[model samples]
Every structure is written in structure tokens, then in C-alpha cells.
Target: MTKPDQIKNRYNRVARCYDWMESPMETAKFSKWRRELTRQVTGNTLEVGIGTGKNIPYYPEEVKLTAIDFSKNMLKRAKLKYQDDPRKISFIEMDAQDMIFEDNTFDTVVTSCVFCSVPDPVKGLQEIRRVLKPGGQLLMLEHVRSKQKFLGRLMDWFNFVPLNIWGANINRQTIDNLKKAGFTKMEVNNLWRDIVKLIKVRNIK
Candidate 1:
């Protein structure tokens, strides 16, 4: 099976039950953080991972939205989240590693706690760069491994086991991945002592 299909199959198994039993406190905090991170965006936006459509309501007025997710089941949940909204958004089932769009098509690329789960975060980030117009920004809200030495070490030790079963890595350093993806103008500020970060990156190329 294709990678996207594998992702879909994996998340589909957990879709119906994920939102309810998932980390409530983490979800709430991430939701609040996404609001702050995305407040800087303007123009056409593509929200990668658009999981469960959790950030759909928080999208600013006047911005055109195109939400993409790898899993059909996740998009279904997100559709329910915006059932009554006056805003219209295009939801597409596409892999973040490769988007079916021309280069320089989008003005902004938004990711809310999505990098950790990508099978190849670097390749996915490169795709974000590929579709984003020059000087456009990539707005990200991510939970990263702690900057503190011992805590980071512990996260590294525990990440592999859970990533196999849970499909997300707790210790992924997304900021580093963005840099590797050729992002240069980056402003990263921690929300909760290095655990959560709001990163705004521009393609300086």
C-alpha cells in the first residue's frame, strides 16, 4: 500500500475514539496556542494535517482556506466541526510530503502540532516550501522535545516505543527540520518552557 494509504488506515482505526480519549489537556493547550500562532497569517492558507478540523473555527475571517489531511476519517471529523460555519473551506485528501499544486501557489502554510507525526518530516517540510510563494510564511504550533538536557534525553528514550504504537514522536525537533528544509527567517518562541513552540518561518530564498 502507498504511504498515504498506510497513514489513512492507521489513523482511521483510531479516528472515532481519538478525540475523546486523547490528551484533553494537551488538546486544549494546543488549541489555545494555535490561535496565537495563526493570528499572524493573511491571504490564502493551507493548513497541513487539519486533523479533526480542530482549528477550522479559529481561522481568521477574509483568509481563503484549503485544509489538507492524509486521512479521510480525520477530514470527516473536521467536516463535522465546521458544519454550521458561514465560512467555506476546501478540504483535500493529500499527503504533506507531496501536494498536487504548482510551485508558489500558496501565501501561507500552517501546521498545528503536525510535524511530529509525519513519516518524513523533512520531505513534508520541503513540500510546504515547494507550494509556498517566495517570502510566504510557514506558521507552526508544535510540541517539541524539551531544550533542557536531561528532559530531552528522557524524551528521546521514550519516543521510539510510543511512536510505533501511537504514531507521533514526543521528542521531534521540528524547528531543526524547518531549517533543514531551507527556512531562514524564523522567529520561534516557546509557549510552555520549551515543550510547546510557536514558530513563524519565511522562505528567505
Candidate 2:
């Protein structure tokens, strides 16, 4: 199977229990991060990985929203959870590396804990850049490789465990990847000891 297919299968297997598995972290940190990230979205918005609809309750009601995930099962759960949300949301199954939207389509793009699992993170981000209008914003809440030499090396050494078991990498240098994907201006807020970051990017082109 292709890498995206592998990721899809892995997520599908865990979809039914995924929300429950993440509840602990969600309650402690992710919930607050989601609210902080979602509330800043404006105009036509695209959420790249709307897993289990966790951000559904936090989004502003006036913005037009479209949410996508490659795993059908995960999207199904998300749709069920927030079907009654006041804002009308379009839910679609799409691969981040190859979105179907036209160029410069979205006013803002958002992600949460997503790029760690993308088979080619730069390619996925390039696609995001392509779909965003010039000067559009990209908001992300992600856990990335530590900058501390010791912890960074430690994460690299054990990165294979999460890659093999969960199809996610724990050692991605995501800020660098964003630069590689053509995002220029950015504000990065360290949320948890340099491990988790809330990144706001201004798409230059």
C-alpha cells in the first residue's frame, strides 16, 4: 500500500476508540489549544484534519467552514459528533498532499496534531499553501521535535516506535518544514516546553 493508504488504515482501525484514547490530553491541554486556534479563523476556512470534530464547538459561527480527513471512519465520527452545530460545515474525505480545491481558494487553513502523520509533510503543506489565498493565514497546533539537544536526539532515536505503531512521527522539525513548503512570515508560540507549538503563518503567495 502507499503511505497515505497506510495512514488511512491505521487511523481507521483506531477511529472508534480514538476520541476516548485522547481524552486525557484533550482535557488537560488540547481543548484549550483548540479553542485558541479555532476562534482566530476568518472568512472561508479549511480545517485540514478535523479528527472526531474536536474543534467543532469552538469555531465562530459566521465563518464558512470545510473540514477534511483522509480516514473515512474518523470523518464519520466527526460528522456524527457535531451534526447539529450552528455553523454549516462541509465534511470531505481528502488527502492533504493532493486536495481537490482550486488554487488560492481558502482565506484560512488550520490543523491540529496532523502533520506528524502525513506521509510527506512538506508536500501536504505545499498543497495547503496552494489552496490558500495570498496573505491568508495558516494556524496549527502541533507537537514537534524538541530543540533541546538531548531531548531532540532522544526523540529521534525512538521515533520509529510511533511511526511503526501509530503511523505518526514524534520528531518532526515542523517549523523548518513550513519554511520548506514556502510559508515565509510566521509567529510561533511555544505552548509546552518547546514540544508543542501554536504556529500562525502568513501565506505570501
State each model's CA lDDT, in order: 0.83, 0.92
How well does model 1 score by local distance difference test? Answer: 0.83
Best by TM-score: 2
RMSD of candidate 1 to the true fold? 2.3
Task: Summarize candidate 2's per-residue lDDT along 1-205 as a digit string, tens digits.
Answer: 1378887898898899998889999999999999999979999999998888898888898989999999999999999987777787999999999999999999999999999999999999999999999999999999999999999999999998877765788999899999999888999999999999999999996
What is the RMSD of candidate 2? Answer: 1.4
Number of the top-ranking candidate, with lDDT as the measure: 2
After superposition, the stretches of candidate 1 with alpha carbons farther than 4 Å from their true spots are 1-7, 26-28
State residue 73's C-alpha deviation in candidate 2, in Å: 0.7
The whole-model C-alpha lDDT of candidate 2 against the native structure comes to 0.92
